[model samples]
Target: MSNNTNKILTALAAGIAIGGILGILFAPDKGENTRKKIADNSKKLSDSILDTVKEGKNKISGLKHNLRDRAESLKESVEEFAS
Candidate 1:
């Protein structure tokens, strides 16, 4: 994860949280209902975040393997040329 990726994810998470909070706060619902909504929204938010992070991790891992393979190929080419 690069700095920009981290910043973007943080910003996204913050935006989601603030939006959820404001939406719940202004809704015309009883306390019990509001609390239940909050719980459900939080659960959804957490799952969403987890999914995003996992996706990023998989992408980064794939990139790392590709780079490693390319580096090895380049190294073999250079060795063959030098020999």
Candidate 2:
């Protein structure tokens, strides 16, 4: 079962690699320009992904801080009520 799964994964990877190679080969730009475009595209994609992750982290952190503040306020209210 594991062997079959590995074979499938390998085949899928090979197919993707081949498709990418063919796409690059048939692309309209000159080789140098094509390389540059690919590099630029890769950088942009990486930057976008990084920025998205950072934004998500900031959102999560803000939520955490807000929750903590609410919890503290609730605790204080309960304490005052019991006094």
Compared with the true structure, all predictions reach lDDT values of: 0.94, 0.71
List clash counts for every candidate, in order: 0, 0
Model 2: how far residue 82 lies from native, Å = 1.8
Q: In lDDT terms, how accurate is model 1?
A: 0.94
TM-score of each: 0.92, 0.64
TM-score of 2: 0.64
Q: Write the per-residue lDDT of candidate 2 for residues 1-83, one digit (tens) a residue.
A: 24775577557655655665567768887999878766766566556655765776688799999999999999999999999
Query: Model 1 misses residue 73 by how many Å?
Result: 0.5
Candidate 1: residue 53 lDDT (0-100): 95
**lDDT for each residue of candidate 1 in 1-83, tens digit (9 for 90 to 100):** 98999999989998998899789979999999999998999899989999999999999999999999999999999999999
